[model samples]
Target: MCKKKPYLLSSIREGARLGIQECRNQFKHERWNCSILPSIYTSSSSLSLSVLSSALASAHSIFGYELTSGTKETAFISAVTAAGLVHSVTRSCSAGNMTECSCDTSLQNGGSPSEGWHWGGCSDELQYGMWFSRKFLDAPYKNSSDSDVLSAMHLHNNEAGRLAVAKLMTVDCRCHGVSGSCAVKTCWKSMSSFEKIGSYLKDKYENSIQISDKLKGKVRRKEKNHRKIPIKKEDLVYTNRSPNYCVEDRKLGISGTHGRECNRTSDGPDGCNLLCCGRGYNTHVVRHVERCECKFVWCCYVRCRRCESMTDVHTCK
Candidate 1:
């Protein structure tokens, strides 16, 4: 596929970048923070095609290790990256960047006339995106047996991620009439912003299901009472509980919360008490300097005065 559709290389790189960045953003306040070890890649060179390919391969290796761990964090990474790939590829299709796909025309000229609206514009081509993402990302686990717990969990989470993109797809419409009067509306389906997708996956991660490690011809929740509850396509699944990220574990690649900045006032995950894992925290006085009190000038320029302030910063001990 890479040789046949060389243009897709850029989209793949963009998709991986989007996924990793969004993962970090969603977990910024958490202990894990979705960080990749510096040793994973040797060089931080610019994103040439070869470099990008290497990066993607390295990411896959990392994800593979996480999959073996079978933790909730691993579930989130699988889902978010899968959704990101679908989003980027779909956007490319909508933009006519690929010869094989363009905006979805299936809904074109199809709508309820009684509602004074009809589908007429270029709806995002999510079908192609979903197909491609599955083919590329899920291809590795395709040969694994159903009883292989790690592969099953990974495949399920990957589909859940793709479903998230489809679940959040929205409709955008344009008014068509004289003087913008109430007459007809042209609507098209579009995917939500990547941020929204990331947020949704984060929520899913919070409520992710833990399946039994043994696969008896199908995946089931670990709890006996919930075994009958059918796993939905949108639900994230994992086989193992996550390790507490309070202390660094080089073997697991966790950086822990030591020296991590924390919110003194907040009671959330970012709060000093919780984030520090009851180990306590340290406070330091830091100075900040920036341009302040800016005013617009007549010559299309602005002037500002330099400002300096001292503040106390808190970090986990």
Candidate 2:
């Protein structure tokens, strides 16, 4: 068994805190930068940071002189609104499912693009950091009916990784796992009638189960909306992370290495489709299918143990 390293856990916690901080800073700066683009776009930093800085620079020579702050702000607002309108089409490009575009024709035809859209397709890249898997169960909670998906992910995974997932996949957790129309009961083999009867008797479980009255309504200190640091009036100010992360010996760990259960990747154990070990333990990415299916491969699935909601990957052959 691998012993939990205190420093290692500390480092992980620090990294999460830092990433959250960085994300907030980036958004705030991006918004502030839009307000200053008229005077700043031609500068070297804007080259790849955003906007075809190159195109904007070339137009600068002909257009001559900088844009006023109001002009920059107006253009920035238009871009944001346009991008939001078109985000559904743009974001699905990488995943090979972009028909849900923001085009007027598509919208008028009673189609919604907000199902999945991101601007400039910038979310396609993977950053160097921790990743997680989230699951959504059919019921508002978990029970024996949900074990199969969890077990299947385990079968294709290492001992340590499986054990961690087993405990972590309870009520209050979310997941992106291998769930099909068939009950997630006893995969690879059917169960006896007695076992099935027992399954019906178990309690429904939820990802966000109430721990207790005191902690129930309490929010995670870190997940709360950040108190925006006020910018200094005299300096060219950049946002700084909150000082809470500076503690000397604070430590944290996920229920499993992947952290929150609801916060899972779209791909199940098969997301990577590789033999590489997941963080803290060994795991192999794979697609699990029963011989019973006709259209079995190349589908993304999400499972919720609570409602016992298992999506259909394909019809049984």
Candidate 3:
């Protein structure tokens, strides 16, 4: 077998440089989104992802019972697929300009000493991939113009799209190495994610959400609960499994789905990200919070678009 030193590869070297650039960029942007942790919002390294493919090229490497790049990549991908970014992994959707790069999504051998390597265990990989995806997703890159960021912000709704962006953003890093390579290391995913109230969130979702509506709703949120748990002005959070957003708002619920009632605020303009949620539709509000938007008559849970402008229903005529 031909033995080569790790630094011999030119492509890897260039990737390392790019990774450094990304790290520097992330350092700069996190200043504005001060509350958003770079680690939780970003992926670790593209160089690692590339190295994974090379390691997978040979089956012998898998049997070596050592930590190979492919095994690391595979295990991490599997964990993320199952527990982290399940949305993107399950759909197998490709981004608009994706260059056909693909990854293996299997991790049955993750926990075994005989089969392959371990990043501790299933939950660990899930957490690792969760953090990995986040770092890339939120990492600031010069690859695309700021306009792309604004445009991609809309893509936040699509789990696969976010994953693709993450993958692409880390391409240079993967080519390089993990030594200070494109690592922003935000503590976003490091902390335990808060619970997701799936059904509870849907019940509170407001429809036809405009920028103005967002402004008004936040104001309403502040006014309605002056004495309650104060969500700091800058803190945000997102789900660990698929569709990550906010990064600081740790407690989460599935996005864009209607479900049984609980008094949780919708996380986005479209609603869905809830601080607390429940089982199914026909949602009933919880006892602790002022339940609104129940199947019952008047629901403050579901807000109305026209009504926000209306003083009286009879006066509309």
Q: Which of the numbered candidates is closest to the native, going by highest TM-score?
A: 1
Per-candidate count of clashing residue pairs (backbone under 3 Å): 0, 31, 34
Q: Rank the candidates by lDDT, best first.
A: 1, 3, 2
lDDT of each: 0.85, 0.22, 0.25
**lDDT at 311, model 1:** 100
- What CA root-mean-square deviation does each model show from the true structure? 2.3, 29.6, 23.7
Tell me the lDDT of candidate 2.
Answer: 0.22
Off by over 4 Å in 1: 40-51, 54-58, 62-65, 145-147, 296-303
TM-score computed on alpha carbons, candidate 2: 0.15
lDDT score, candidate 3: 0.25
TM-score for all predictions? 0.92, 0.15, 0.18
lDDT of 3 by residue, 1-317 (tens): 11342322332233223322322232222111111112322265333434322321221222221111111212222122112232222112122111232232243333333432332211111322334234333243223454332222222322332232233221111112277553322111111211121111112111111111123223112234342544321111121112322222233221222221222243432222231222222333223324344353364445523212222111000
User: Which prediction has the highest lDDT against the true structure?
Assistant: 1
Q: Residue-wise lDDT of candidate 2 within 1-317, one digit each (tens)?
A: 00332212222222222222222232231212111223434445432222331222122221222111112222222122211212212223324443322212211223222532212211221111101111111121123454332222111111121122222221111122356332222111111221121121111100111111122222111233432332111111111121211112212110111211111233432222110123322233435434332343446654333222334231101
Candidate 3 TM-score, C-alpha based:
0.18
Which ten residues in a row are the worst by lDDT in model 2? Answer: 125-134
